[model samples]
Target: MVARYVVSPRGGRRAYPSIASALRAAAARGRPALIEIAAGRYEESLVAQGDVRLVAADGPGSVVVNQLRGTVLQTYGSVQVDGLVLTNRDTEYDVVSCWQGSLTLDNVEVRTPGGVGTHARPNTRATLRNSVFLHGRTLFTASAGTIERCRFTDAADNAVAIIEGAQVSVRGSRIEGSRIHGVRVCDARAEVVGCELTGTGNAALMADTRAELAVADCVITAVHAEGIMFIEQSRGSVDRARVTDARHGVGAASGADPVVRDSVFTACRDTGINVQTDARGRFEDCRVVGARNIGVFSTKGGAPEVHGCHISGGNVGVAITEGARGRFTRIRIEDLTTTALRIFDPDSTGVFEDVRVDRCPAGLEVRGNGGTTAEVTRAEFHDFDQAAVALAGQCRVTLTGVTADRGMLGLGIGEEAQLRAFDCRVTRVSSGGAVVFGSARLIAKNLTVSGSEALGICGRNSALLDITHGEFTDCALVGAAFDDECTGRLVDCSVGGTGDMAVRHNGLVDLASLTTSLPVVRNREPVPLPPTIINVINIINQKIITGPTIHGDAINNNFAWGNDHVIQNQPTEEGPRT
Candidate 1:
């Protein structure tokens, strides 16, 4: 048999005067119970050890249960509360706690001044729907639960906290004006979908300490910290999310990797996506716009695999620095105030393929020690005010099938940088097409430097050049110029439509071919020279039917110091986020 009880403050209509008295009677009866409270204020605390449903006789907000210091309600068995207001001004306890069994709250309002509004402990499940939590956080400590259509506002702590290996699913929730994080997961996991988190003092969503948080169709805005932060080896994924006006749209560090897909980050103060300290996040099909500093920043063992992304209106597009290795493919970077892609410092290598950079001052800049290396293939640099591709410091880079159009300078290699360009085209550059200085080395094979406003190829300041089958045409100035103690072998190269001299050598340039070759622009790679042939006869006497001679042991020994990979990057996974 079931028992029913109605309670009021003054025992109206022969009902119990207090909720505790009725609960005591219901417990004495020892049966499944339903307790209906009248429409009035109740200054009380109640504990239910058995199954019970506590509801207001009237609609929601008609019954106000307020506790001054301690928990207002604590349940050990399955409990359901509906159409009631639970308020507590406790400083050291949860207002409503489910300790042993499940709790279902529907159309309930909880307001706690200094304690948790609701706490679901381990081995418990909390089902909250259409509830309002104000000035308190809902804690799921080592528990499992689902929250649907809930509102959390003005939380003193995180709006919702999932910790201690708990797992929760939150859907269609709105969290606003949180003093701390909107949602924080530590050593736990959560899946938040169709949620809006705004006005958070800290990160809107934080996954730390091996926590995994999956968010989809979410909007996070007005965050003082990062919109989404992953740290301490956390794993997570964000899909179809929009983040705006955060310090960093997404920040990952301490071995945390967040797989971000189909997301948009706009007007972030710092970098759009920041990965550091061994975090290897994969960002795909994302758009980062109006970032103040950089669009994508990966450094210090952070190797992000970014592809199919568009970045614009940032100071710099992407920066991979300080032992970070990244694989960037099909990335379009445009309209930046500074460089498009910057690879700097030691032990950092970037392999860029099918990348396009436009309207940036410096397109692709590589500056580091020999530990820094880059392999760029089929890159397009357009409308850059400065050099399209610039290499400085002591690094090595290889550019193959790269096209630079309408740039001030095409390729600028300086300061002990070694660059190898094969089947590359530099057209409509205002300055020189390929400029090598400051003890740099260039092994240019089958390159076309045409329609340059100035000289085609300029080598100066003790630079080394090994050019083979380089075709220069329609240059306003000289075709090729080597001055100031530059020494190299130019073999099987042609120059045409130069307003000045075809080939000008001002200093001691060891040219193997004084007589220019025919203007036959062969559509093929330059052949490697045999080492035995270069060792016996002088380079000048040999007809040299070949390309850049670096493959041959005779010439490879001259510039072999910058060819080693000091640091190898680990693999980056683009599979579905866990």
Candidate 2:
């Protein structure tokens, strides 16, 4: 029962002056038609087929559809464009061109200086409410769509270009000043809710081939490059997103797999979430701030799973290289300028849990070409200037319940690195608390080194240090130090306030049971069987032999009489060699 036609340029009275004679008198009254256009410039180029209703009596700046070149409204079956103002001064074509149509645009305003602004063609179905698409190159190609309260301004390339098997739903949208891509899905399926993409040149949401994107509560700002770009086998899901100043904030490569939840990436110049080649990404409760480079970056064989993340002021906070693999949980890396967790190639693998590194220069940097494996659990390295866990070449690390405070070399095992520390705690370190050099291998068990100024466990060149149950107190110089062609084994060790020396060897050191309250053995070169001094406690002017040949039983040594404690082959009686 829809048939009402009234069009007027000036002379009214059952009007019908222009509007192509009221669409040929509503297609000779064939069926449903309501063409009520009044008030102004209608230099028209309109074409509709069966059911049409183009109503704009006084609203939409008083009706103007001035297509000076090609298409300005061309529908097929069912169309309803109410309160219109479509321009299209034509650099070539489209400004609203639906084909096998069911188009509905209420309060529409599509002003194009160059081309496409709403061209829903292949298996068409479009619906835009309270719309505005200005200065368009491509603003909405929408194969099947629903864009509510939209405003896509100054779009030169793509502001919503959902392709092939399209399913688009964008609510409360505002894509602003987009030169390249602000939402461009290929084998499409896009659902962006409460979106606000600002000043995007390249990628503010660009999902390629096998696209399926769902971005909720989005606010992507100043994106010069990737702020959400999922390539080849594209798959995306970003919730509560806030990406700012992006180069790469969520960029998944070839085999893309993206699931980023509760995201917040700010001031990103390079990578705040970049999973490469064999991509697998899943981040929950994420936040990466002020990233100049690498706040979560996995390379070639990428495997990323970061949960409860917070990385701040980054240079490299979480960077797993070439043959990448990463799995982090409860990570908190703060003020990182150099390395807070950087596991370089060599078939890389990193598994961290409850990691916390603060003010980093280098906190957990495992690099050595190709056999990198870092497995950390409950780690906390604070105020690191250099090495709070730095294993160089042939890296294989395993740390459980690790803690290094005020660090400057707390666990720095160099080339051929292999470290296994369990229940480790190194406090107030300046230079050394666990430093094994060249052919590095350190296997510690309940190691605790207090206020260390220099050597509390330090092994050199051919290093392989193994401490079972070690504890060193206020060590300013030496509590366990092995030299050049080093090799060590301190089973049940304990050293007190060592300002000078307590167990210092040259090459091969094996102390089964060593407990020194002050001085036990400090040999620079000579060593056969020194440190077996079990609980030697007589600290007056402590100097317990500068050369090592002191074998096991120093018989509960307690010498403090004008102390000249030098027990060298004391079997003259059973008094000192007990």
Q: lDDT per prediction? A: 0.83, 0.78
Candidate No. with top lDDT = 1
lDDT of 2 by residue, 81-131 (tens): 888888877867888788876889888788888558778877778898887
Best by TM-score: 1
Expressed as tens digits, the lDDT of each residue in 1-578 for candidate 1 is 66889998866676999888888888788888899998999999988768889999988999998989899988888888998899988768899999988999999999998558999999899999999999998999999999999999999989999999999999999999999999999999999999999999999999999999999999999899999999999999999999999999998999998899999999999989999999888999999999999999989999889989899998999889989988999999999998898898887999999999889977888888898999999999999876788787788999999999997778878778899999999999876788787798999998898898776887766889888988888876666666566767667776777344455554354444433321211112222222422221221112111113222366443211111111111111121111
lDDT, candidate 2, at 221: 87
Worst 10 residues of 2 by lDDT: 535-544
| TM-score for candidate 2 | 0.45
Clashes of each: 0, 2
TM-score of 1: 0.88
